[model samples]
Target chain A: MERTRAPFAALREALHAAEERTRLPVARLLLLVLLLSVPLWPMVDSRWLRILVLVGIFVVLGLGLNIVVGYAGLLDLGFVAFFATGAYTYAILASPASPALQADLNWWLAIPVVLALGAAVGVMLGLFVLPLRGDYLAIVTLGFGEIIRILLLNVRGLTNGAQGLFNIPRPELGGWVLRSLDQWYWLLVLSAFLIATAVGRMRASRMGRAWEAIREDEDVAAGMGVNTVKYKLMAFAMGASIGSFGGLVFAGFFQFVNPSSFTLAVSINVLSIVVIGGMGSTPGVLFGALILIGLPEVMQFSETERLLSVINPAVPFADTTDWGRQVASARFIVFGVLLVAVMALRPEGLFPARRPQARLPERHESTA
Target chain B: MFWFDQFVNGLTVGSVYALIALGYTLVYGILQMINFAHGEIFMIGAFAGWAVLLLLGGSAIAGPMLIVALLAAMIAAALASSFSAVVIERVAYRRLRNAPRLAPLISAIGVSIALQNVALKLTGGRDRVYPRVFPTGEVGLGDFSVGYIQAFLIGSSVVMMVGLIVFIQRTRTGRAMRAVSEDRATASLMGVDVDRTIVTTFIVGAALAGVAGVLQGLWIPNIRGTMGFLPGIKAFTAAVVGGIGSVPGAMAGGYFLGLSETVGRELLNELPGVSLPNEWRDVIAFSLLVIVLIVRPTGIFGERVSKRA
Candidate 1:
């Protein structure tokens, strides 16, 4: 009877350990369901796919920015510069004007090139501003962004100037054109998931620890044997590389590259996503991107507009001549208000970092 | 001939930048947070002045009434700027005092965006033309020529700067401001109203931006919702360049940035193979900011503050 009892107790302990091992994976699976459930809803509109794509792009951007602003604690006001680099890189490389390259370069090819270029630019910029920190760093980055934009605007031969590059072909996988919004939506989801997973792994690795150390106290981090300069450069390059990847995807999906698409406003929007979503957490970035991107898109429906019109009748305007301007202009106000409210009330974010749950010990009687 | 004209043009713009920088420096000296909305205040001031001029000149008030309108606009700008500063402090900053340092910075950005949108809504998303209040006549000083508008902007900015210097150095409140800036807790113990002092710092800074706005309207002759963004950024850069938290530093930074922009453009034109068009002038200005930040983080005159402080 004692032998039988001992075997039962060991079996129960083994079962408990297995459950604990699978807990996080189960949680992740649930989160995946929640994310995918939107598309599966019976009442969900096809237009939502487009919004999801945008959310994916913003998530990519937010994750990249999280490394710089969240992990490194650097306020980078000019992050859009990397986005521009990627977009332009794709534009120039894929465009027919290039001697060897056709107007429609393969998506796979353009992405790596864009990322490499972005990383190079990031490294260069990091070197340039090595001496500056805090507000000074912010201002320099802002200037750098403007410089990139101005160059894009003025360098007519390369960028096609303010008119921007258009008619670039959409991405194709072995003639399987991702032409539909739904296909693109799925593509973005897959890519975002992969990137998020990789980012999660990276965050738990040695590099992530270095970033945390640097953020908390740079001098102390350096003293603790963390290679401060190397880690900072790594953060910048990795962040820029991720941002460029998003840009490549964006350019490929739209089949157009314009200077206006990558602006200080774009940088601000991404920054707002990181801040509102929660700075350092992976899930926080995803949530932030969804809210910032999805909310605005959802608000753009005709019914929603009509409903808002009832609240402020004067807003819709009697003349429909400039309806586009009215619609476009409303976005800035909404974005601004959201940014302010989020920063004021919940600066930490909606899904702040949660403490890991402890395993409960089995109840046992002490041997006399 | 055109070369000399551009130099004068640069000086005039630089002087305006100097005026705006003063406000940034003053606020930073006390709060250590950059007031991102200060530029929007400048834009609002210009728009207000434009609106006032349009109303007064178009209606019963004419001729000398225009001067009265200008004075009214200046006073209105000061009040408006001060009010904005106070409100920003109350709503956005006060709560974040004990939070992470980045908290206020983010809040400031939010305020900036909100104010920009407000300005856009107020202006109906269009540029408002300022009434031709300042005479466009240019006077010759040797080979260089300065417009009447330029003179007015420079002169008024200098006078305002002098008045501010005197106020800070001479008055009890100004002394209190200095004391608070030097040490907030100690100043509070010494009977300084720290909150009030911070609010006052914002007001003074905002008022200067307002004056600069009026001057900008007079000189530029057009105002838009986003007109303040670049100028505001440049002014902040100027404040940093001269030395953030130093009153005189703002003036020096503004002038330096302005002069550098002007000279850089001139130099670019003179380069054997390179020539940047006039419309792309902002490129030079922004590049200068990057270069300055890289070379001198403390700026030319700015002293580095202890991180704890």
Candidate 2:
């Protein structure tokens, strides 16, 4: 494992030759997949499953954003709008607030509706933002996101305002209720796997190459007869669709929908996962999701405080001290600092795509 | 008369927004970067003013001394914010000068979050009442009146804007700043000291924001760590509506945004069968942003650049 470069290279070469000789790529891939999924099954009763579901939600979100920002090179700061939209759609349909709709709607029936609505909204937003470029586009998207949240907050008739929609009906398959943490975890695992695979395949397709070209240089891509506007819109809609699907899962797991949950911070967090994970890599997004979700959970302050006091008798601060609360509150400061440090040090993120690039430039400088 | 009162009110608030938007405009004009932590500097200004008020034996002083004390607090606030702005420029933005657009933007966001949290820690997330140093009396003709603080704001903001116009149009340093904005590389090559110009741009912008913060203390008087967030966004919106990277555009945008938000709310309320909530007022500013981007694209005073990405 600690071999020098020469040995490691020789071993890697031998392994590749052996792999080619054996033609066991599929077998090895399956084995790797099995190894990943098998461990999740045991975490059924544990809180780890809850964390896994959280990571899965982000995975779907990161995958969604990867298409727009990573592949198409659009900087969208309003991604949470789509996520919130998807969640609210399901929440409104299933919650008791809309009894007429909920009494007849099943989870299976609601799925496609959410997906379609998400895609439609994405496209609608896409149309509005299509003409803009770079930071101007970013600000417009941010404004749109705030507008959605404010609209949600004000349109008390549909969303129940800030009180939020609770008692959202859980998904079911005939007689089986998908209510347990493990059940939700499995559902998310399947969803994440499906999304990652579909997106991964899509990344290598002709459409993906066109998107990559646009990302590299939209003008050049357009010069080459690539329909930049259409491809960018498609990327937006696709990203929105996937992101909203994630929102659907989040609503299902929590059995609630709130405007507060879908803030600009959430969008930034998802963006962080994508950017920090290596923007275009599917596996990187998952790994980022795991780190962001699991790391915070592992650093649960009260438990850490207890461990600290146990390890050191001279510890003056008690568990009930304001110091613990400060640390909890200070996590965001840590997160903010980390975001800056990472963007500065490694803009490529933890794992990078083929090209670790900067943001696309805007056309106009007269108005930012 | 009622409309007159509303008009006066809009102008007063618009003056405040203009004060805030000037910061956005100045920085954007020179650096082409949105200083996201600017709002936090505005907050810092308020806090610094509060500290000054305390240091001057409290806000309970009398008459001429009160005026002198208030002015001192405002100057202190301006200095504090200017210092903070320079620090943010050097530490967060300087290193990533050539990095992609996302890096600086994300770094700005990070600084914003960190500064806000630091403020929250300092204040324990409570809203502190800023002292009413300025006289609270209203003065004017019958049925057309303005508060003492509002008058002060309107008067001071105009003076500052006029003073700024003079500085930029007449001064050598201001000419250098304009030169940098026009072409940074060329300006640097031709003895502009681009870094100094950028730093000056930040200081001047931040100082206005600090003064705006003091006015916020005078106007609203209830200050909190998160107070800057909404106003910052609105000012940014104003900057855009005026035309981002345009000095006069930002000024015009701020006042226009302020008037529209106030009068727009009034107009919305008057519409038959429309019972829009008060929370909708905040959305007006953001909505204005979207509409401007869509319909105008170049904003009110912005010069249209015909290019595509």
lDDT of 2 by residue, A1-368 (tens): 23336976666555545655666645446535763575456534356666777887988999999999888878898999999978888888888865234554567677788789888998899898777776567778888888899988877788898888888888988887888776677677777777877887778777898899987778899999999878888898889999999988888888888789988887888877888777787777877777766566655647765664455533455544445544655666777777678777876777877642222334211121
- What is each candidate's fraction of native interface contacts (fnat)? 0.42, 0.46
Which digits, one per residue and each the tens of the lDDT, describe model 2 over residues B14-119?
Answer: 8878888889888877767778888888888988988888777776866888988889988999999999999989888888888755667777887888888888
Per-residue lDDT over B1-309 for candidate 1, one digit per residue giving the tens place of the 0 to 100 score: 777777777778888898888888887888777777778878777777777777676334546776788899888877777787788789888877776666676677777877888787877888888777665577877667778788778878889989999999999999999999899999999999998888888888888888888888878887888888889999998898787888888998888888778877788788898888875677777787777666766878878832431
Q: After TM-score superposition, what is the CA distance of residue B236 in candidate 1 from its true location, in Å?
A: 1.2
- Please identify model 1 stretches exceeding 4 Å from their true place: A1-24, A97-104, A309-329, A354-368, B58-63, B305-309
Best by lDDT: 2
Estimate the Cα RMSD of every predicted model relative to the unseen true structure: 5.8, 5.9
Which residue pairs collide, candidate 2? none
Off by over 4 Å in 2: A1-45, A99-104, A291-294, A306-325, A355-368, B304-309
Q: Model 2's CAPRI class?
A: medium
Tens digits of per-residue lDDT for model 1 on A260-329? 8988888888887887777777788888888778887777777676666555435453765545546545
**TM-score of each prediction:** 0.90, 0.90
